[model samples]
Every structure is written in structure tokens, then in C-alpha cells.
Target chain A: MAHTGKILVTGSGIDLTLLRPLEEAGNSIVARPKLLSAAELKAELRDAVAYLHGGEEYASGDALSTAESLKVVAFMGIGYESFVDVDAAKERGLRVTWTPARRPDAVAVFTLGQIIYANLGIRNRLDERYPPQWSAAVPMPSELSAQRVGIVGLGSIGSRLAGLLLTIGCEVSYYSRTRKLAETTLDLTYRTLPDLAAWSDILVVLLPENPSTVNIIDTSVFARMKEGSILINTARAALVEPVALGNALRDGTIAVAAIDGHYRDESVNAALMREFGPRLLWTAHVAAHTRQSMAAMVDQAVRSVLRALDNAPDENMAVGQ
Target chain B: MAHTGKILVTGSGIDLTLLRPLEEAGNSIVARPKLLSAAELKAELRDAVAYLHGGEEYASGDALSTAESLKVVAFMGIGYESFVDVDAAKERGLRVTWTPARRPDAVAVFTLGQIIYANLGIRNRLDERYPPQWSAAVPMPSELSAQRVGIVGLGSIGSRLAGLLLTIGCEVSYYSRTRKLAETTLDLTYRTLPDLAAWSDILVVLLPENPSTVNIIDTSVFARMKEGSILINTARAALVEPVALGNALRDGTIAVAAIDGHYRDESVNAALMREFGPRLLWTAHVAAHTRQSMAAMVDQAVRSVLRALDNAPDENMAVGQ
Candidate 1:
């Protein structure tokens, strides 16, 4: 076990102080101060046995062609969809891993907040009430404990969120690609996508953005949702059709929509704001921005790379086949 | 068991159906459609043995002098301070009660939401980003699990909120008039107001508003609080000095303030908004406005009156000495 391997950290703005644990473990660190092209990265990758990756560079094709010694590449964030070419890495026999799924606790709490915010109509109240007209007749919000909440994704974040909602006595149901066989013991009911949409008083979207999920919730899904139901999206904007959502909110098909993520284009935000205005509550994709989550993600990424370099088995670290 | 007592319900907008539970128990119901004068209430009080009160007409001296047969008076909502004259009720041998202690679970969840909201700087990020300038360099919010949270009051709502925060792994401390005897087993430390302010990265105000609590969090307390700390108030607006809070937020003494309650004045809200628009996250005092809480309050108020009429030794239900 007397190995001094070179671990390359790709991308800038990473607080290198957090990687102190890796350095103290007797690894030689090579960090790229800026994002490099495939040609530039190949030279650095040639000698490094491990890499901590953050840039949007596709890692399998030309990027990994010269990395003869490379055994592992660890993505620093939860989502590795467009950031890495996992199939190519699999083909090359290189281990690939991503950080813990979406900082489960942070996202879960944020999801609960969004649910409360939407059901309570806080945004509309904030917008309309400059000097909130004191009224006992303020609309009574449906209790979280009394309503049926249906989640679209039941991954780590969604599962944790389901537990939180259950703690508040919400009747929880979820729709995933497959039934969560491991979590059958939880107090969650499994339903088909359309059934879930139709049943939910509040439908939460937590599915990761992927080729199969793009525009998954459109006019059809909106039409199927219960009348005056709410929508909360914390996962990705690509999963929802903004135009359809805007119409639903305006026509009261949806009572409210609390979104923390949007399409990468600024125009989408502008359009949503223009159409929905105060009917939409926005947070800047900050569900996973907690200091603890960020630190844990980096620490785990470093550990995964170290585990790979030492030939230790990592059943959960590797992302795809 | 043959009691055909008359129960008078004061104030407008009380759902008549909630009183059906009392009527089913063989009580005749009388509801005041609007705020009544002392003379009007005296006439209603002549026949009524139990009362559900809402209007601010003080029940003291002359008001209680006329309520000859009134054995119990229940405040329809939690706050009973300015609504009832406790000394008068006690002298007149009448029991007074208030319903649903801020819906402990509802307020606890809302308090946690405010902590996360303030710590995450959701409003600031929303104001600054359009479609979010995606960056790994996003400001890292202090983790809820990693920091110390100081609560100003550890009553039902605060005690429940402390438990919720503890579940999230926060190091919790509090400053109450007296240490909560029941919560000595909880992982909470009792601290002086100044010490709690100095030690906390997030200070929560849940104190019931009284003559003693008004303007308790003045400039001196703000000075004692840790720099970059956040404030959350779900209790009362009078507890915080808006001018001082605005100054702290503007000067960066406090990073953010999330408030759910405020002084019922248009000018105060306008002034606070004009000073710290984005930094002050506002929720319209709807923390306990859930349908579940509302129904529970009404149900409990009815039950308390029934219990009082039955000659039951109910010490806690009677609020005044």
C-alpha cells in the first residue's frame, strides 16, 4: 500500500483547502486552475492515476485517450449527466463516481419548504400585501397533514423528503421509473405517473434531468393534475414545460408553482416571470448550496478517488455500467 | 348530565359547523354576527353560561360584572394577552382559556423553514440571478446542522421548534424568562439573552408579546449578536425594533431576517420594505393559519368550555390566575 499517486483536480474555484484531507493522505495533487480542452487535459491526465472532475468536458473519448494511467474520475457534484460520458468510461474500464445524490437532507428540507410555501400561497400574499390588509378571512391553507402529496422521483432526495413529509403526517405517494424495491417498508404508496398526477393535491418533481425525462411534465400531465393543485420543482427545469405550467397557473389548473430550478437560458426565467409573475415562487437552484453539503460532496469525491487508486471495492461510487 | 347550557360565540367569520360538535353535546348555541358593545354583550351574557370570545372588548370589571352565569370564557385563537382581563376573570370566579398554542407543529415547521430560508439567502439569490448564473462559486450557506441556533422563547412553539432543529443536528440554545423544566432532557442549553445572542449564528424570536417583551431585541441585543447572524421572528412584531433591525441588516451586522409576524401598521411595513427590501424575507403571519390548526382550535375551545361546565378540575385550560 506504499503508493504516492498523482490526483488531478479539474476546474477552478474549488476551495483547495477542503482537499487538505486528500493531500495529508500522501497523494501528490495536480490542480487545473482553469477549464482545459480535451487536448490540454490529455497531457495532464497522462500521468495522473486519479482525477476529481467538475468541468463540463466529456471525459471518455479524446479526453481519456492519453490517460493510460488513469484509474478513476470522481465528479465533484451530484449530477454527472452532461458533465461526463459514463458509457465511454465504462468501455475504457475506468471507474467513475459522483458525489452523494443531490445532498439529500438539504434538498429534502427545501422540498418541504416549497410545499408549505405553495400550499400557503406565501408568494401571492407577499406580493399583494405591501401593508398586508389585516384580515382573519385570509384564505385558510389546506393542512400538510391532511393533503395527499405525490412525488415524481423517489431517489435519495425524494425518499428523504418523503420521510420528512410523513413526519408532518402527509399521505405520501411517488412515481419512479421502477418501484423502489428497497424502500417497500416505508409508509409510501407507489403509483403510475399519470395516476400520481391525478391523485396529488401537490405534485413535487424531483426526477433528475436525463434524455428520457426532458419535457416529461407537459400540457397532458398538467391537465391530469387535480384542479387547484400545486407544483413544486427542485430537480431540473427541463422536466417541465414552462408554457404549459404558466397557462395552468393562470387558469387555476394549478393554484401555485414553487420552482427552485429553471432552464439554463435567462429568457426562460424572463418569460416565466412575465407570464406567472407573483403566482410563481423562485429560488436560484440553491437547494444543495449548504456549506455542509458542499463540503461533504468534496470530501466524498476525494475518498472515492482514493478508494479507486488503492484497488478497494466501491460498490456505490461507480455511476454507470 | 342534563345540561342545556347556552354557549355564545362572538366575532364574525367563525365557521358555524365547528360549533355543531358542541350543539350535538346538548348545548344551545348563540353567535354574535359582529363586534358587540358592552351593553349588547351584557344582554347576550345574561343567558349564556359559556362564551367563545374574539372581539377586543376587555372582559373586566363592568363586562364580567354583568356575565353573572358565565362560568368559562374561551379565546378563539392562541393570543389572549390584549384580548382578556385575567384579573377580572379570576375575581369573578370565571375560567378563561385560549385555543391551540400556535399549532406547535405548524409553527415549528414554519420556523425551520425560516431558518433555512434566511441561512440560504433565497431572496438575495432570487434578486441577483436570472435563470441563475450557474457557478460552483455560489455562496455557501452555513449548514443548519453545523451551526448554533438560539431561541428567544421556549414555549410550546419554540420547544417544538428546538426539537425539530435538533433532529437536523443543530446545536440549540435558548433564552426564556425561566428555563423550561420539561425540556431539560432535550439537547438545549439555557443562556442569558446577551450570551445567547453572542453565541448564535441564527437567533429565533418566538416570545409571546407582552409589556415586558416589547422592544426586547433592541440595538444593544443586535450589537451582542454575532456578525453575519440571521434573525427569524414568528412570534410578535413588537419584540423587534424595525429601525434597529433595518440598521443591522443594512450594516451587515445581520445577514438576513425572515419574519412571519409584524406590527399591524401600514407605515411600519412600508418603512421596513423601503429599507431592507430583499434582505427581509416576509411571510404573512400565516404560520398557524392551516385548516387543521383552525379546526383544532375551534374543537378544543368547544371541549374546554364543555369541560369547565362539567365541574372538571381543569387547571391548564384556565389561562388566568
Candidate 2:
């Protein structure tokens, strides 16, 4: 039988204009605006050549087993392992690809913005009706250029942030799995996590979440940080222990912090919000939600689907092919 | 009679440690932690060879005539014209010097911080407890690097900000008194104020308060600006017309704005605060209040006093020597 050339898009809210390139390539789109059940996804996969996964619905083993024509499972985001059953897809001889592009810049820029907001004491002055009374007792805020910035991970986002910090004349250091020799030319120094914490006036956490990485920034790391230093975490919240973070904020081990990603538990957020107030800048995981990044990821996901359909998947983005 | 070597400091809260350089030069420091009256200032100036003029007290012509040994009026800040009688000082052969150093970087950094704060929609997400619901209807925020930044003045602070913006990959343009030949090499474009407003995604007001510059950013400029554009003013409050700014915010001609300086009138602040809540990020004139800048200015002021005492004044800082 000839190919149907149908691509199934299962997401609550995907921009149709971004899928124009896929349609222009002579493929028909079967878009399910809301997340579908496993049985519904199985039925939709039977006619489609590729599935554009939207991260809400899990592509279960049963769904993969039922698909007759589906060659690829293209995830719109980086964390494909959580949504797609890799072994099941491999059993069905299907390619699983994800878009891991354009997010590093988005997250890095937002992290820098938060760092400045904290360092400049913008929160204290936010609600002041009158002008700040300049006095000897009231200490002045330090300049961004004069700060020593230590990044926890030397991944794409961390390295990009390090470069941005260097441009602003900040002393940049990192604590990664291994020291990057090439980055030394860019004046990046490698340090142990504890030492990085001690030396940094601004410690930024950007590590990926894994078994070993989860809760890595605990009480020990907080204890080593400079008094009145800032902490900026744009990474997963699981990397930082909530109890340790709350203690650090309470005892003044860390002067201020801005966390982009929050805990899954509503009670934890409520507790943190009630206890810390403006000292902690907590936000939902929206650091990588820029218009530029969204458009780029969507385009990359579509390209990944098209490439997989042609039996030539991108090695960087492919998981189990 | 020999020189008294006495320097009168007339700022309410000047850091004495910053004035140690002057003391180490065999000078006796007369620290008056208050804004003195003209009669009180004249009485204090009779014995002092160099007067460390603070911004608060007005050095009138009557006060200048009373000074017997005062050779230099070393203003601790840039705006000497507001505090010192230049014609009176010039007639008495007294050198007037003001510290105009180190503030550009301070103000520029703060301005960049506010720009990022506005651009990233941090204000919107600041109070959001739940994760943002991503949908096609909800528009995404633009990346800072993708922004076209239009600077109202290419003076010290504006030029420094333009350079900082360039390092982050922003398209920078300026409207100044005259086109800068040297800056064009750095990829800075010269535009008319209206053209700049129209082209910019972010408009920064950095002009000094003068007859020609005051109220430069009025209704017409706001009308020319891109819809949903951000305005950041770290300069004088008078430069931006208050009524027009309120109107722009009300009608949504501009999405958000961050102003560091506030008007003198209490009623104006109260009215604006009541009307535009989070759409405006208002702060006192504390953008240039960094520790580094403060120390540098105090040291510069001391050096200017020392140089004038030796009959060798810094020509760059001298007004009417």
C-alpha cells in the first residue's frame, strides 16, 4: 500500500502556522488539539506516518504496538524520555526524535535578567513611594561588573550564560563533570562545586535532573556560599532541596534567590511563598518560553519529523532509532 | 598665614572612609553631617582652603564673597551648576570642579536590568503561583537579543548602555545632539528621535535635564513608539512628561515602563501609583548609587580638591577656573 503522508499532532495548543512547512511538503495534518487517551492515540497513529508528540499524552507501548504506518515519534520538547516509551518504540522499529534546540539562549537570557534584578535590589525599591534616603548606614548595592559568578553546570545553557557574564566583565567560573580545556581561552576557570559556591557572589544552578543530580544543591552547598550572595536557578527545582533552600533563606546563608522552576507539590510552593516572600523570586518554568525559542523549537520538531520520515534522522536529536 | 589644610564636607551622609585619601594628605576634615545654610557655609569656608561642596547646600554669591582662603569648590557630584554660583566663584579666582566619573557604568547596568525585567514579562509572572498555561492565544515574550534598542541620547550612560546592548546581540540606534563618527565603527546607527521611537522594541531615555531636553519624551514620542514597546528612564524625571506617560500606560500604547527617577511633587507620585500599578516599575533615583561609583566619585572629588590646592587643577573637571 502507498504511504498516507499523514502527520498526527497531539497537543492542547500548537500553533497551526508553525506546521505550514510540514503541510507544504505534501503531507496532511491530523491535529488533536486536546490530549488523547491511549486508545484514541493508537487509532490516530494507524493512519499517520509520524506522530508530533505534545508532551501531555504519553505514547504508551500499546499505542506504539497498534500503529501500522507510524515511522517516527517527534517530541516538541527536550525531555522526550518522560513522554515516550523508548523500548516500546524500538520494538516497533520506530524513530524517536526530540527538539533540543534554541532553549539554551532563552533560559540563559532570563537567568541573567533575574541575576541583575536580585543583585541591584530592585525588589526593595519596587514599592517605595518616596525617594531612597541616602545615608552612611544604608549600604550600597554592588555593581554587576564587579561580581564573581559561578555556574554549577557547564552545559549549553551554562556556557552561554558564562559568555554573557564575561561580556559584562564578571569573573566567570564553573563546576561541571569535567573541565573544558577549550573554555580556558575564554577565561573560564574550573572549580569543585563547594569551592565555586564559596568564591561566587552569584551562584547560578543550571544542571540537568537525573538520579545523581537531583538534590545536589543541598545544605552543604548552601553552607559554603558567601554571606549575602545571590542564587539563581533556572534549572529543574528537584536539583535543589526545598528544606535546605528554605533554611538558607531563613538563616541568611543566601541573601536573595530567584528560582524559575518550581516544585510539583502545591503545598511546598504555598509554604515557600508564605515563609520567604520577596526574598525568594519564585516563578513557574517559563524561562524558556520566549517567542523566538517557541518558534525555533516548533520548526525543529517539524524538521525532525520530516527527516525521520525520509529514513535520515538527525543523530543529535534522535534517541532510539 | 599658612594654609589651614581644613576641608569642609557638607553632605548629610558622606562616607568618611572614602575621604581617607584627603586626610592622609595632611588635611584636617571638618565633617558637618547636615545641609548648611548660606551664612553657616560662609562661616565654615573662611578657614578651609578647599570646600567639598555637597549637592544639598546652595553656594550663593554672598557666601563666595565671604570666603577668605577657599581656592576650589570640589563638588562631590556632576551637577555643580545647581549648587555653586559659577560667576561668583570665577570672579573670586576660585576653581569649581565636579566629579563626572564612574556613573555611566552604574546607570547603564541598572537600565539594562530594568530592560530585561520588562522584556521577559517577569512582572506578569512574579505573582503567578501556578505554571503558566501555554496556548496559541497567549503570546510569548520576545528575547532581549532579538530586541531593537533605541537610545534617546548617546552621552556617557547611553553610549555605555548601547555598547552593553551590542555585546548581547541587540540592534542599537541612537538620537543625540550630533552624530558620533567613532561610534559608527561599533555598528551604532544614528536616527531621528521619532524614527528611533518607531523602530525600537525598547526605548531608553538617558538625556541630561536641560531646556532643550526636558519633556523630550512627550505624547508625540510615545505615539511614534511601537505598540507594546518598553520604556526605561534612568535619567531625570522631567525628561519624560508625567501626564503623557500615564496616558500611554492607560491606553496600552506602551506595554510597560521602568523609571528610576521620580518627580518632586508628592501628589503626582500618589496619582500615578494609584492609576498604573504593575505596568510601571518605579524606583527612586538610585540607579547610580552603586558602591563602586560612590567610592570613585568621592575619590575623584578629593583628588580635584588636592590638585586645586597645589595650583594644578584637572582641566576636564574644572568649570570656570
Candidate 3:
């Protein structure tokens, strides 16, 4: 295991020094410091025993078939399903793992920041022509402590955000696929999706993007939301229906919506930006882009690779033989 | 006390319903909803026993002299020194009080939002030409939990902010006029202003705007701050020198600064906005302008006014005969 054939890393700007421990343990490293083409990745995987995936190149069934000696694939991010052919890798008797070590805290902090920003209604004033003057006419913002916050997914990131919101005195509720019995002690009330939307002063979507959750927040959900409530999505853009969100903002079904990362369609984003302006707080997908999170992710990915190659148990293993 | 004469309210947009308790107790409410001119204020004060000050019209020695029957003045906000002539009120044997209840939490929450927003470095992307793209080059942001935050004052707002930071795992220290023994149990360390500035990755100024505290965060303090550190001011604008802050940003002594509320000079703010652009996150000072804070302020102001007239003890009294 120590003298594994090779470990391939496919990611740009990842500090290679973080992988020095693996290099020291006798595995020769094949560092492709950029997203590789499918053929390029397949060619590289032929002689590798372990693959440190960057999630940039698609690891298709065809690519996995080419890996003659690959034993494990360690994805550097939580969303491995988007890039990795897990079924094909399992058929090849390869263990696949993802790094979810520090992402929850990072995304939670970013989402908290976005919620507070939107609640304060500061987006409208970002491009004000005159300097901000203190006026009684400036509508008084409601305190964040008093807000009834409804989280749409009780996953790690959502749970972390719920904890943060609790610290600030927000009344937090959630709608998850399954009721979390363990989380009941934390004072989180369980609500169905419609009930959560109806009761919330601020609704946040944090579900993963999959067949069941894609465009989960659509027209019907918007109709159930409280008027003038805030909506925040730090999760995948596909989890929220763009057209419905645009309509919600336009018709005042919700006061404002902030979506981090880009939608699949640039035209849809451009049109929404033109019409909604500050009512839509959009940023690049940076919810989990913190230096601390990145470092921990690299470390966790490396650990998973080593564990898999050594035929040892790894908690992060998503697909195992 | 129940039949007190002419209790004047001089603040605009205060929901008069909040003053119903005072009205019910038999005070004659003289409502001047807008900020009065000095002459208008003087004329109205001639027959008033209690004045609910709006901190708008300058309550100078000349204006106070005309208030022959004005026994008490309850300023609606914290910074009464700017609007009310406290020494002049003392000379006339009057009690002056301010409403400080519920403001600390409001400002603390807003300041926390600003710190997180600036830390994430999202201001530059507000006006991006194209939709945001995921790139490896995007510099990872440092986690707020790992930040060493140094607060420049240990007043209520500062203490509240420190408590909030502690919950997020930040290392918090303060440079206050005197060390707080009670807060010692809360894991807050005390440092000299220069030392605090030197050690902190993020320096927050929360000192009141008084003669001694004005321009306290100037060139010397900026020089002591860690290179690429962030500075946040949710307190009065004069507490940090504008020119020195601009210079610091230019020289890279600090990476970013977010100042809530407007500076004294419009030209200076305009020039800084032009030069610094996104490096300076400036907002219209809505930190304490929350619905909860406003309602609490009104109620507290009314109680102070009633207590002063009734010759009862009042804790909010800033100046007492």
C-alpha cells in the first residue's frame, strides 16, 4: 500500500504541499494541475491505484473501464455524484469517497451572512446615487432575533446554519426527507415543506441537487411562502426553479431572494438581473470556498485515498465494493 | 404626576401608539411629528413640562433658555450630546435622559453581518459584467471562526458583539477606557489600543463619538494594524479618520474596511468611493435602525419623561439636578 503504483490529482491551484505526506509515504504522484479532458483522464487512470478527483473532469463509465489498476477514487468535494460514475466504479471493485469534513461550517457562515444582508435590505442601496442619509422614512427593519426562519433541508450545512441562527435568537424550523430524531434535542421543530414556507419570515433552501430535489422550490412552493419573506439558496441553483423565483420577486410573493452561484442558463440570470436588480442577491458559488474549508477538504480527500488503497475502513466512502 | 402639562414629541415617524401609555396616564401629548426649526422648537418648549427630543433641532443654550416650564428632556436616541446642551439643561435645573434599551443587540447584529460580508470579499462581484463563474483562482476566504477580532470599546454594543463573535469561535479582545471585571468570565481579553490593533486580523471600532474618542483610529492605529486586516465601524463616523483610512487602503496596510453610516464630509466619501471602490463597504448607517429598537427607544423615552416629571428615580437620566 505504501508503494502504490501512482496517485493522480486533477485540480488547479490546490497547494500541492498539502499532499507531501502522501508523497513521503512512497506513492509516486501524477499531478494534473487543471481539469483534464475525458480521454486525457482515462489515459492517466490506466496505471493509477488511487485517484484524487478535482470534480472538474467527468469520470464516466468508459473512463472507469480504462483504469486497469485503480482501487479507489477520492473526490475533493461533497457532490461526487455530479462528476463520478459511482455504479461503474463499484462494478470495477473501486471504493469511492467524498470530502465533507469542513464544508458545513463554511457554507453555514456564508449563508448566515447572506440572510442578514438581505434581511437588512442593504442590496437596494448598494448603487444609490447620493450618500445615505438618516431618515425616519427609511423603513425600520425587523430584528433578526425575532425572525421565524424555516430551513428547507436539515442536512449538515442546514443544521449548522440552524445552530448559528439559534445563537442569534432566530426561531428555526426545518423540512427534511426524514425527521431527525437526534436533532430534536436542539429545539428544531419539524415542518412539512408547505407548512415551513407558510410559517417562515425567511426560507432557506439547502437540499442537494438530485432527481428528487431538482427544482424542488417551484411555483407551488412560492404560493405557500409568506409575503415579503426572504429566500436564500446556497445549495445548487437547480434546487430552485429560476422562473418561479423570478415570478415570486416580481409579484411580491417573497420580498427578496439571494442565490449563490450561477444558474444553468446565463440568459435566465441576465433577464432576472435586469428585471429584479437588488431584490435578487446573486453571487458566484463561493459558499464553501473558504481557505480553512479548502485545506481540510484536501486533507480529508488525501486521507480517504490512503485508507482506500490500504483496504482500511473510511467513513466518507460513498460507494464501496 | 398623572396630569403633567404638555409632553411634546418632536421625532418624526415614531408610531405615536407607543406613547399611548403616557397619554393614558393623563399627560397632554403635544405632537410635533417633524424635526422643528430652532425658533419653532423654542416656541413650543415655552409651555411644555416634558420634551421628547428627536436629536434633530439643536437644543442649544439659547433654545433651552426659552423653555421656562420644561422640567425634563428625554432624547430619543443614545447620542444626546450632539443635539442637547446638557450643561445648559443642568444650569436650568432640568433632568436629561436618553433611551439606550434594545439598541445594543440591533447594532451588534448589523455589525456582525458587515464583518462577515467584508470577510467573504463579495463586494467586487456586485457589478460583474458577466454571471459569476467558478474558478480555481478565486482566493479562498478565511473562516470567521478562526479570526482574531479586536474591539475598540467595551460598551454595551461592543460587549454584545464580542459575545456574538465568541459563539462563532472567534478570538475576541477589547481596548476600552477601563477593564471590565464582570466580562472577564466571558473569555474576553483586554489589550491596549495599539496592541489590539497590531494583533487583530479584524478591528472593530464601537466607541461613542465624544471629544476624547474622535479620530482615535487614525494613522498611528492604522500603522499598528496587521497588514491585510479588515476594519469595521458601526459606531459614529468620526471615530475613524477618513483620510487615514483612505491612505491605509491605498498602501495595503489594510485589505478592506466597511463603515456603516455616512462620514462628515460628502466630498471625502465621494472621493474615497471613487478611489477605493469595493475595498470600502459603506452603508447608510442602519445598524440601530430596527423596528424593535425603535419601539423600545420610544417606550423608554416616554417612561423617562414621565419619571422626571413625577420626581421619581430614573436610571436613563444622563444629567440630573
Give the range where candidate 1 chain B is weakest over 10 consecutive residues by summed lDDT: B127-136
Candidate 3: stretches off by over 4 Å: A1-13, A19-73, A91-95, A126-138, A306-315, B1-13, B16-58, B62-72, B92-94, B126-138, B306-314
Q: After superposition, how far is residue A41 of candidate 2 from its true place, in Å?
A: 11
Provide the TM-score of chain A alone for each candidate, in the order shown. Answer: 0.76, 0.80, 0.84
TM-score of each: 0.75, 0.83, 0.85
Q: List runs of model 2 lying over 4 Å from the truth.
A: A1-16, A20-73, A79-95, A133-138, A306-317, B1-14, B21-74, B82-95, B133-138, B305-318
- Which of 1 and 2 is ahead in TM-score? 2
> Which candidate leads the pack in DockQ?
2
| Whole-model alpha-carbon lDDT for candidate 3 | 0.81
Model 2: per-residue Cα lDDT at residue A51: 88
Residue A82 displacement in candidate 1 (angstroms): 3.6
lDDT of 2 by residue, B1-321 (tens): 224488998764366888887778788999875557678988998888888875356788898897888888988765576568888888898889887765677888889889988888687687564436555434678889999999988877888888878877899999988887636766798899999999999999987665677789999999998778899988877789999998888887788889876675667877888888777888876777788877787878888887887776486455654
**Backbone Cα, N, C clashes tallied per candidate:** 0, 0, 2
Quick one: how many clashes does candidate 1 have?
Answer: 0
Q: Name every residue pair that clashes in candidate 2.
A: none
RMSD after Cα superposition, model 3:
4.2
Q: For candidate 3, what's the TM-score of chain A, rounded to 2 decimals? A: 0.84
The 0-to-1 C-alpha lDDT of every candidate, in the order given, reads: 0.75, 0.80, 0.81
